[model samples]
Target chain A: MPEMTYAQAIDHALGQAMAEDPRIVVFGEDVVMLRRELYVRFGPRRVRQTPISEAAFLAMGVGAAMAGLRPVVEIMMVDFIAVAFDALLNQATKIRAFSGGKWNVPLVVRTSCGGGYGDGGQHEQCLWGLISSMPGVSVAVPSNPQDAASLMISCLQSEDPVVFMEHKLLSDYWRDYLGGGSRKTVAFDVPENGRIGKVEIPVKPFPPGKGKVVRKGEDLTMFSLGVGVHRCLEAAERLEEKGIQAEVVDLRWASPLDRELITSSAERTGRVLVVDEDYSAYGLSGEIAAVLAENGLRPAFGRLGTEGVIPYDVRREAKVLPNAARIEQAALTLASV
Target chain B: MRMSAETVPVEELYRQMCRAREFEMALARLWEKGLISGEMHLGIGEEAVAAGVVAHLREGDAICLDHRSTPPLVARGVDLEALVLEMLGDPEGLCCGWGGHMHLFSREHLACSSGIVGSSAPLGLGFALASQYLETGGVAVAFFGEGAMNQGMLLESLNLAAAWRLPLVLVCKDNRWAITTRSRTVTAGNLARRARSLGVPARRVDGTRVDRVWRAARWAVERARRGRGPSFLLAHCPRREGHFLGDPMLRVYRDPLGQVLEIAPPLLRSLLARPLSRLASRVRCLGQIGATLGALGLELLLEADPLERSGRLLEPSMRARVEEEARREVEEKVMRAMERRVSRA
Candidate 1:
């Protein structure tokens, strides 16, 4: 097994897919810098760079997808999606349903989201809620390198649009994007050399929302997304020390959530706590509550997320974003033990 | 300028324009019968632009159209029956009832349409980018309205196409109206100049003349095929039936007396109840109605409809024959679509 950083896993996935498929093209602002080897391997046309035109390039990806080319576009920052949302919310999401399946938009949008290195509100955001609310988009938030690699492969093979979100803290490129070091401790351990992490969750193609229980217990279930899953794991370990057992489920795929996994997990423990970095208002936590309620599950439920606007100060950002202590506290409150 | 009729055969173009015209007229009739729901946009006037550009498209060429998409789709030889069924929301239709007339897709022709304005340019860029990378030797043509040229994405597409040297042709059918607003009132500068500034060779043509549009489209399409980047063409046509099939102002044109009687009483009442300072504005409203009615009357006096202009290019007897054939084909498709609906029901 090859050890991998989250970014290397993504690069490996791109190289593997492009090796097998001639239709894959990667492009965005400074994407060549991140996937430099891909640029060397796939040549300029396949790994092209574009002007700072998010809306046009994204829409072009949609058109390219319809033209039978699978374009994996990078959107520099998830905050930049604001300028290109018409492409995402309307064109990319509506084309399949509008074309009545006559067209399959195999467009994968790779973007970096999450905050820890003091990139303000504009630079850091987990807008999965905005996209997951739509009908025809699949969102994959990989918490570890292996999950990122597997999810990238699944997204590339999907017949529709998939949004692959990488947390800035975990992506290998973060070390170079700014002077910040890669948060290897924030993710699960990868093998020593080849960049493959230990977490191996099979991602169902397209609308993948399967949850992987990284740590199992019988007391209470804690669900989280992306980097927050690691926080949940740390919290679960602490909870175990205090004689409180916690099951940690990493909700890898955001949209079309695995209802069966969520319901059964909640039913088994009779208690549910959703910990995430996305804003709590109309976000992932709220969505999980709705899903559980829709499934008729009446468990003791608690949720924690960014309190409000993410600040520029590192300490204040930490206060707003979830940490292991907050997760443990939220879990203990829910456990009432 | 040399007449395309002198240099080329245009009976085929005339026929193409006729089919597009007739096909849309049939769609308008269907909308009138309430068989198709939602706001129906009919490409009743821009037949020349569609026929002219589509005539140059060959195997592997791709197209993306605006909301008024039937003209190009008809010219491209897409299954008319499938379009009709799709418009009628039949599951067996082209898009299985998911895509309505505004959101049509034809896999066989590699054609697509979107309700979003200015989308065709980006789509064309994408398709052309694919053609460039795959070496498919296919040219991607985008059909949009002049209103779309104002959008940032279209300009961005122009810039990208130039930078990438993608094989793309951008055709803007200038109907002089963005929905109900006059295009020039909201638009600034020249459209062709803007494209040219972005390094795209652009031309403006009289869109009602199929031969003129045909020649312009030929030059642009050829340039694209030669890998000379994109060309922007502005075809000044008219939305002969107005913005959509049932345009509110279209009623004012169709039934002036009835519309004035229905609207004026309230308008006059509000005017009298309002401050005298608003008298000029109130009177301008009535004048605008009269202007719309007068414009309709004026349009009837002129041979401005593209289909009629193109039909004149062929011999009268040949013109009649082509029109009859197109009419019969549209009727057959309409009947087939109806039968599909009945069987499904």
Candidate 2:
């Protein structure tokens, strides 16, 4: 079995996809550096670099997709997608729908998101809620390296536009914080003729809109995605020490939410806690709570996420964004209720 | 295919312009009758720019249009009946009624339009980039107004097209007004200068003169096809109508009913013209009468077959037959589409 970091997994997935399909082209600011080896391998034609023109390039991706090629546009930071909102929301998301399904935008906007290094309000934001709110586009948020690779492949293969979010915290730079570089790599079963060789590490097939219960228990179900999934697992472990058996469901994709999985989990546990890295109000947490309520499931619900402002300081962000301590406390409170 | 100014066809250009004009006038009439809902930005006076530039494009070439998009779509050879049905929110519209007049798209025609300003530039750049990547020899044309000159995205698109040497042509319809505010008041420097600053070749043409526009577009399209990067065209023209139909200013300047009455038979014109003026000022009773008369007159004009009305442009004997054939073809297509909608419903 081969061990690969989260960044490596994404690179591998992109390389494999490009190798299989000549139509796929990747372009973004600084993508040449992020995927330097792929650039060298694919050359300037397939893997191109663009000037700092997010709106133009992003819309270009939409145009390219409509014309005939599949384009993977990388927005260096998720928050910067705001600049390309017209392209993403108005153009890419609505093109197929607006065109009466006459045009399909096979575009994948892969962006790195999340707050941990105090990268202020402008740089760090888990905007899955915002992107998922759009009807036409699919939103994919992967928790681990294996899911990242699989989901990236899925996004590339999708006929419609997809926003693939990568949390900065899951990158190799924070490997030390994730347990002193001792992170376990899970590899998925690759197809026989897959471009990349089969590895020993286990891989999970991240089908769009399906979630997995990472740690199952009966006391309560903690719903989270991306980096929050890891935090929820840690919180569940802490709860286990205190005789509380918490179940953590990693919601891989946020848009076509795993309603049945959440509903069954909520019904069995009767207590739901949604810990999100995005804002609490009008975000994924509220959405999950609404889903449970709408399904006529009266579970004891508690939500924890960033409240109002995303702070620039690392300490404040840690306090604002959901951590294991907060998730544990929120879960315990929900269980008591 | 490189087209020189001498090779630009006048008859075809005239036909395209007439189609755009008649289509828009029909839509305006529909609006007046309360058959169409929502905003419609008609390109009544800007038909030349659309006809001229679109004539230079082939089937594979792409075009992205702005809100005042009807002219270009019509010029690009989109199904006329489909366009009207789309505007009417019919299910068989080009966009299946999902997108109204502003958001019309026809992949078969390689044409798309959106309500958002400054969007066409980037979108067109994408099409051009695809052409460059695929080596398809197709050029993408972006049609915008002077109002979009300041948009960061438009400027960025210009820069990118130049940087990558993508086959793109940016045609700016400088109608001197961006929805009532004179464009010059908000815009600084020259419109073409903005593109030239980004290392893109640019030219300004008289948008009202179809010949001039055709020649300029032909030159730009040739440059792009030859892989010389993007070219910016500033089309200076007039907005003969208000931003939308039923604009008070439009009526003040050019009243359809008034024009019809002016061109009416001698006795009817004299009698109606004098009384209509007296009645128009009475403010109460006469105002209502004037409104009814205007509506009635416009309806009568719409009923008078477009073929008969097109006699002004075509040879009187040949005009009626040609118009009848054209109208029947369009009507039959529209009827089939409507029947399909009914069957589906």
Candidate 3:
């Protein structure tokens, strides 16, 4: 078994999918910079560069999908998708449904989301709520390199449109921030050479709309996705040290939510803590709470997420985004309730 | 300059225009009767543009229409019954009632329409790019109004289509109005020149003249099919009717009754005749009677007789027969769909 970084895992998945399917084409602003090797390997036709026209290129992806070609379009930041909201919200998401399921828009919009590196308000946002709230589109928020690879593959294979979200801080540049030094590695079953090391991440068959219980416990169930999952895991470890055992569930996809897994977990634990990096108001955290309530699960519920507008300063951002300490605190409060 | 009828089939063009005109007139009647709900943007006078441009498109070719989508859908061979059912919120609609008049779509016809302004351009570009990649020799046509020229997305789509040399044709129906605001008030410079600056071949045509629109669209579509790139066409036509039926502003149209009389023949107008004495008896209030008389007069004059006129241009008996058949088909289908909805309930 070898270890791979999150960035490398995404690149590996894209390369493999593009190689296997001739219909796949990747295009976006500065995608060549991120996946240059794939560009050289697949040539310009498959891996192309696009202008800064988010609306046009994103819609081109939708049109391309309607024309029987699979397109993987990348928007540099999640916030920028707002510029192309007409295309993403009105066109890509509703094409199939509007066409009465006769038209399948098989496209993936890969965007970098979340904050921690002081990227400021415009660049850093976890808008999973916006995408997941809309029907006819699926959203994937991978927590680790292994999940990232499998989730990307699942998104590529889906018959509908998908918004695949990647957290900026979880990429290769944030390995140190992940508390993993240069030699640190996470072991997996599959072995492949990544930019950092032999890319070995346990290739699990994690289907879309499914949740994975990373840790099992009876005291409380913590639900998180994307980079917040890492924070939840660390918080769970810290909680164990204080004699509190917390179960952590990684919700991979937001839409077609894993209701069974989440409800069963809450039933077993009798308490729920939702940790999210997005804004607390009308966001993923509230959505999870609503889902739990709608399912008639009356567990003691608490939520930990950013309060308002994200700040640019590092110290302020740390307070705005959910951290391990905050998660633990929220969990303790829910347990007490 | 007057367009040559030899350039395209004038009779077929007339028939297509009549189809669009009659469909919209039917929609207006339905809307007036409170059967069809929601907003409807009628393309009563802009029929030539849709009929002409769609005449040159192949089955594999795609089209994205804007809010005033009835003309294009009718011209693109969409089933009138399905379209009406969709507008009526029937479950057996083209989109199973999820998408209304504005968001109607059909993959089989490779046609879609959006209520959002300036959305069709980018979506059409996508279709063109896919056709280019598949080497399918299909061109994507985007139908918008003069109002959409300023939209950043539409401009971006123009740039992208030109940059990639995608087989795209952008048709701007310059009706001079964008929902009451004159387009010229907001638009600066020339729209055709704007596309030309983006490296696309663009031309303006007389939108009322189907022959002229057909020539312009043919040149653009051929250029795209030959892999030359995108083309922009500005079809300068008239709105002819209000932005929507029953629009209060249309009361200001000069000789509105006279214009309506021109479209509806004397026979149909007589068929809708009602005694003023009976009308007064039904209405107790003078103001209500006045409003009722005005509405009835307009309804009698706007009875979609232009379709009969256009059909008579080819063969009067054949046209009447076709319309009768279509009326029966629409009525039967609508009844069946309504029954299904009731049973499900």
Query: How well does each candidate superpose onto the true structure, as a TM-score?
Result: 0.53, 0.49, 0.49
Which residues of candidate 2, in runs, are more than 4 Å off? Answer: A173-205, B1-345
Best by lDDT: 1
Q: Candidate 1 at residue B208, lDDT? A: 91
Residue A197 error for model 2, in Å?
Answer: 16
Local accuracy by lDDT, each model: 0.78, 0.74, 0.74
Docking class for candidate 3:
incorrect
For candidate 3, lDDT tens digit of each residue in A1-337?
Answer: 5566777688777776776788999987545334544554555567666645577788999999999999999887788788788777899888888888888899899998877644345556788887787878899998777778888889999999999988776775332221111121221111122223434443433688998998888899999888787788888999999889999998898777898898899989999988888777787777777778998888998888878766433345567789988898888888788
Instruction: For residues B287-334, write the lDDT of model 2, one tens digit per residue.
Output: 432453454345333433222222344455555554455456555655
- Clashing residue pairs in candidate 1, if any? A2-A194, A2-A195, A2-A196, A3-A193, A3-A194, A3-A195, A3-A196, A4-A195, A4-A196
Worst 10 residues of 2 chain B by lDDT: B266-275
Tell me the native contact fraction for each prediction.
0.00, 0.00, 0.00
TM-score of chain B of 1: 0.93
Off by over 4 Å in 1: A1-337, B1-7, B269-303
Candidate 2 per-residue C-alpha lDDT over A103-170 given as tens digits, one digit per residue, 9 for 90 to 100: 89999999988866443454567888988888888888877777788888889988999999887767
lDDT of 2 at B140: 98
lDDT for model 1 comes to 0.78
> Which CAPRI tier for candidate 1?
incorrect
